[model samples]
Target: MLSLFTIISFVSIRLAMQHLTSLFKCQVFTALVCLLLMGLPGQSYAGKILVYPVDGSHWLNMNILLLELHKHGHELTVVRSSNSWYVPEQTKHYTSITIPTSHASNLEDPEYMAAFLKRNIEIRSRDRSLSSFVALQQQTLTLLMEAHNASAHMVRDILHNKELVKSLKNARYDMMLTDPGFAGGVVLGRYLELPMVFNVRWITNSEGHFAIAPSPLSYIPTIGSHVSDKMTFVNKLKNLLHYSIGQYIDHGITRPLYQGVISEFIDPNTNIYSLMQGADLWLMRVDFVFEFPRPTMPNVVYMGGFHCKPSKPLPPGLEEFMQSSGEHGVVIMSLGTLLGSLESEISEIIAAAFARLPQKVIWRHLGERPSAVGSNTLLVDWLPQNDLLGHPKTRAFVTHGGTNGIYEAIYHGVPMLGLPLIFDQFDNMVRLTSRGVAKVLEVTALDVDTFTQALRDILDKEKPYRENIRRMSQLHHDQPMKPLDTAIFWLEFVMRHKGAAHLRTESYKMPWYAYHNVDVLAFLLGSITAVALLFLLTCRGLCRVACRKRPRDKKTKDKVQ
Candidate 1:
């Protein structure tokens, strides 16, 4: 084909040369060559992006995304609170746009997380008592109410800041990238009227899918349900109840959380749920390998392990420690960024459990050392989690089931022993456990023996966990393009095209009745009912006429006789 195309080009060049001098021939040939090369793609212009990131682990992943965009020559402006611990005010990758610190952003206060974890641990330790359960419910709701109210205040502050608002309006960013875990970013994005993209897993109310996609309660497990996609009758019943609870939170709590802010800042008539659902694109931090197979949308691009990369070099001492594990291999433990550390009793139990193991352990501890220290264990305030997970001598991961850590372990094909603390952590562990990969130990029931057994179970060569996780890893890595690249490509696509409205669903604009086609169903049912009634009435009238005719005919016959 190349030779044939070359011959054709030569013929065309020859035809032109016949009417030109030798000096002009070279110029004509070069001109034709240049025209042929025009089919190839050219460089695209850099786009301006406004980022409104959720702090903590949410910021961890969002920062990775923005950095990649920076590498691609895009300008970024990150909106943050003055008191935000996770989102720094100064960064070389993006310009800072700070708003006044308020109660809304303070829901992310570190002390709040510690107290939340402490309260949850205390409640979980109760012996199936009603008081414990009540306490759990009350604390959770109180915390949620506080968080939502705080976020609303954050939104209000952002809107009321005339200078900040004016700067943003003047910037005219191509897109607004945000985490929809809180409605602060979502509300601001709508007010800015930019092409919004959600770096999302959970929305303000529930998991992001529940907000926009078709989720069947019978199969798609709700948060904290501790059930899988495949459910027994009882599990289905439990899932339904959890779904109802989610709905209550969505309506009773989450909606009202943002209503006042929306009314004052955006439009009075705008529904917060509708505004959240109206994003042009959702860069979902999810993968089918890690998640249940559920319904999704066209504009939602799943990039679950986009933050994961090839393991860079581990520090010399860490590498030596990993090497010292020899044939037994090592175990790495982390509770994610949110939880500082477990209660002392739980830590001692974990330490004792690790002490019993022959394999070396590297624990990322945030508090005072436990008394039951193991000779083989090395405790650090922080470790290169991805590097350790991807290490050849690393046998297993002991994690709190944070999505980032889960994906990193998945990326490395390391089986996990999960000690889920709170929030979506328990549910995240359930998915992996159901897949025959990770083993989960309830934090409330954490004892030395149980933790030891679970750790050994995942590390056992005879166990299918290693094999199952390896298979899952292969599936994750088998993509045509790398997950991060795919994410950035689509994001840049949005910037290049201005917005992804063509891929977005207009179902967001439809009311609940119209979205579910309930109105259409009602009309069709009504039409059917009317047609059936009309048919019945016509039949009755015909029968009555026949009866009347028969009687008249009988009378006539009698008279004639």
Candidate 2:
């Protein structure tokens, strides 16, 4: 198990032994060789790693990371449910640790996700009113409840499996790599006394930063707030309200869901709301290039656009279609994996809009074909999204504002026409729009005329979107190192150090008042008030004594007269 440094040093010593023997003793040379091997552990021999990943589209990026780990000769063992829809049972990159699970039209079921999206679209498309907003909040709560319940069930199964627990301990994984969106992995990592590194943007309850770092509501917009960093007074108020709602969901819906399982299975004293915050390292899936500038932690590493890369050759016939667009180039559209479908009327409008455009269009349409689809449009069940976005001919992107797609667009410098339907897409689009690289349209307000004009504006050479996005792309590429490589470095850094306790903040262990210094502020204010009151009393007493002395002096003067 020689390291890169060891191999080079050994070769140099063998070649220069005659010269070295004249300068140093044999023991010195031996010690130098040992030091080379021991001190320069360029990754410490790729230690064993355990992965707990989320399924569906989330698995796609996690798989990329796992493959990279495998390339470095790290052994990976992934924990998955039997009902997982995306994670494969077998892969050369990692061994599967599958748990038995039962499901019917529920979590990981295509129908369930489809129905959820459908319901979300319905709620969002409704008129803006109190009832509608309330309904949306309720829907969000329900979804959280169901998702955490399923995760808790899987966690319980894993913990209760006596044989599996013993096997896990015996295998001795160096650390746990996971998506903190689910609490199961965090709890388990603690149980095994293993350091944790999170591949994350979202946690169980809200955004990961809100849970781990000092996030100010003044500028950091909440997810569902539909606001930006440079917010107006009203917009700032909206952000605060939305953040409060998020806290409500975190406490009311998510905490309750996992509280029982955590108390019974993991540590009883751990708080579900902040459990994920205790991870040794956070490999943030986004960076300042895409996300707005905000306070971040030392352990939080930004690796946005890590999955993006130079365009490879397009699939058969795809290059021909892209080339056929000529002067106008091409427009690409994708709504992401789970929520790719659109209503019949909306699809009709979008297709009609595409038909009028001179540029050739490629849409990742999964549902029924639209009647008004253009002859120039290519509808595929799936497409090489990164390849197409990275293509030189990709003039504009129409997307649902998934973080992956947005980052890919940013990486390729592709301006966007946003149709943000649900989840973080709405806020993601808000950021893009504020940057002037995107045109956002309300789903309910979308029409053939508006959709056509928006697409045309993005494709128009005179528009600033192209230039703005190109600038963003430049900034994203200007990093000292690639995001993926940086992620790997930190991952290995954690393993080499056993854990990054120094980088990790202990503020997570403190109560809210203590963390915020509320108690400290209260004590200081009380001390100052007490000192002021005492000073005022002494001044009043001196004034009274002086008045009494003046009266006595006047009476003595009268007696002398």
Candidate 3:
């Protein structure tokens, strides 16, 4: 009896072991299936991506984009000028192709380019009154034509480069991501026959109410529009004339060179600004945190604070520097890329303003130090801007109101003292000032006292600027999805969808005047009047014939009688 019981127990144990083995196999199969499903190409990963940067600068806003692309598992390549200087932090992972650009014989270096631009601005300003505006427009046209020619040469060099052309020819990219400000990339994307995506790193025209190819904030001095935007009837008429003159320059001058020189790469019909409007998607680096309510397209995604990355511990020396700045907290002063390394007089004015301030100042001075340095002020050639802003001791920002800077300040919920130098800075400051989150200091007119007072006012604890900025910061932080994630999602979405053609707007199909439907009323009146005149003429001819025949009838009646 004992032997029989042992046998049964042994058999039971063996059966149970077999059952467990079968269960394990089933689970293993399920897991393999799951992995396959997860790894299968989603709708988003279908094509190659080409990213063209405006220039190689840390401020180009390409770093976060590259990171996002990596997370999505897509390949990207960048086309940049041979002379480009990209910061490692911004371009560590991406593969780049250097194209030869005949930008100008004079702008051989960045410093030279900076001085050249400044001189150009000064010359244009001086000639504004003395020169016939039309003559001035013609000169501007000549410059644009030259720029287009330069861009064309670069495009041809890129297309003809044996290895480069082979790579592009072999790679089946669905879309091209480009910053339209760069004439070369703008023209190149048009020829690629792939869908274009615009990353408006700065403010573009509020779509619909007006389609400014670039941002339209022109009230600020030094970089405002040469054209007028006055509201009066005469001013409106003058603006119309001005725009016509400007278009003449762009078309009669710039476009001709692009066609004659660069036409080989792009289709004859495809052009830069015109083709840009037909882009499959647009990512505007605009946050509701900084810019106010404005018209934007349904397809236009606002990914303003996309540049913010995971914060890391501050460097030991930097941490100590901040700690030494004391309890009131330190202020970050930067004039952004365009205004960096300004003239000595301008730098002195900035330094003098800082000397008056009581709070510790950390100025990102990219040039030589001022002759007089205050103990309270610390000058660094560069700082990890986003990291510094994210720091607790960062109390306020003194900026030139560049779009990126404004958005960064908003992301950190820091108040601003704006010194708008040019371009869309005026519009950016106007929005900030209206919101009471910033104070605008027009650099052309601001005195040291005015600048100091503005900074002081913003730094005051009770000031609404601080409170308002806090509110905006909360809103910025409380976003449904982080800007980077949103950017990645769309970028991936385009890859999966093979260019997101459904997102493209048809506004470009209409002519400039037709877009506004200005001719509709005239068309209706002309059609109606033409039909009425035809009917009137027919009736009048019939009446005249009857009148002449009546006399003949009377004569015939007399003969019959």
lDDT of 3 by residue, 497-539 (tens): 6676676567677776786677897798899999999999999
In model 3, pairs of residues that clash are 43-496, 44-495, 44-496, 45-496
Best prediction by TM-score: 1
| TM-score (C-alpha, index-matched) for candidate 2 | 0.87
Query: Which run of 10 residues does model 2 get worst, by summed lDDT?
Result: 101-110
Per-residue accuracy of model 2 over 397-434 as CA lDDT, tens digit each: 99988989999999989999999877899999998988
Give the top-scoring candidate (lDDT).
Answer: 1
The worst-scoring run of ten residues by lDDT in candidate 3 lies at: 219-228
Q: CA lDDT, every prediction?
A: 0.88, 0.87, 0.67
State the lDDT at 380 in candidate 2. Answer: 89
Candidate 2's clash total is 0
Q: lDDT tens string, model 1, 162-258?
A: 8878988998899999988877888989999999999999876578898888999889998878899999999999888778777887888888888
Q: Which sections of candidate 3 miss by over 4 Å?
A: 1-47, 56-59, 87-92, 101-108, 116-147, 160-166, 201-249, 252-254, 510-523, 542-561
lDDT score of residue 499 within candidate 2: 90
Candidate 1 stretches greater than 4 Å from native? 1-43, 129-134, 535-561
Better of 1 and 3 by lDDT: 1
